[model samples]
Target: MSSDALWYFARGSGVVSLILLTVVVALGIGARSGRPAFGLPRFAVNLVHRNAALLSVVFLGAHVTTLLFDEYANLRAVDLVVPFIGNYSPFWQGLGTVALDLLLAIVVTSLLRHRIGVRAWRTVHWAGYLSWPIALAHGLGAGSDADTWWLWTISLACLAVVVAAVVWRTSAAFEARTDRAVRRVEPRLRAGIR
Candidate 1:
């Protein structure tokens, strides 16, 4: 394909990847509550989270592959793994590289969760929360369409949803803790303890 086609494909894939990543993040937070989301069962929410994550990976690969092939991008293979090494906009590209590395670690640990154990897997999975914002910043700083109204709309919307989901998750966790404390206190009060 032509350089222009490759560049366009890379841009499109990158945007799609970002959107899918957003979905994965929001669904992941929702899944943690062990409650239904978007009228779907808990299992369905988890299923969508897993599938969205896989799709984001596929699109991310496409974005990188297309950029590597596009003559205009001037992206070297090493730049894919190493942060801040690209010829064009190194800092912005480096953010993407860092996010990619984190994602790779998460995916690897997830595949080996059974062997590595849940505690280790959970630790690695937490990196997903970190990667999302880094990836978002990378897109804003590195993308040629960064200033476009459509890109801004999509990015802002994604940010809004993720932030909302995080707030909900934290509140739910706090409520659970409060309930446990109340339960403990109730029993003590019933026994006439001070």
Candidate 2:
């Protein structure tokens, strides 16, 4: 493929990956509430979340592979895995590397959740939250299209989705706690206990 094609492919895949990752993160947060999403059952929501995550990984791989092959990038194999070793924009590139490593860990643990036990898997899964922001920052700092209006719009939209999901999750948790407390207190008050 021509260098131009490779570069365009890399950028396209990266953007798609970011959008898919945002969906995965938002669905994950919403799933925690044990509520259906967009009229889908809880199981369906989970299925969509899992599939979106897988798709995001596929796009991420394509993005990385195309970058490696793109003559303009001039990236070495080691640069993909090692943080801050790239010729251009080392810090931003390093963030991408870190996000990649964290995502790999999350994927591995998820695949091995049964063998590793829930606690261990859950611990690693928490890294997903951290990885999303790092990946976003990397895109903003290192991406050629970062300065473009459309790219900023897409990025900001992704950020808004995640933030809204987080807020929903927290409010759901708080409501659950309040309900439980009310349940406990009502019985105690009815029984004449302070």
C-alpha local distance difference test of each model: 0.91, 0.90
Off-target runs (Cα >4 Å) in candidate 1 are 172-194
Clashing pairs in 1: none
RMSD of 1: 5.0
Residue 96's lDDT within candidate 2 is 89
Best by lDDT: 1
In model 2, what lDDT does residue 193 have?
Answer: 98
* Per-residue C-alpha lDDT of model 1 across residues 1-194, encoded as one tens digit per residue: 98889999999999999999999999988777565665678888998899999999999999999998988889999998999999999999999999999999999999999999999999999999899999999999999999999999999999999988888777866568557768988989999997
Q: Return the TM-score for each candidate structure.
A: 0.87, 0.87
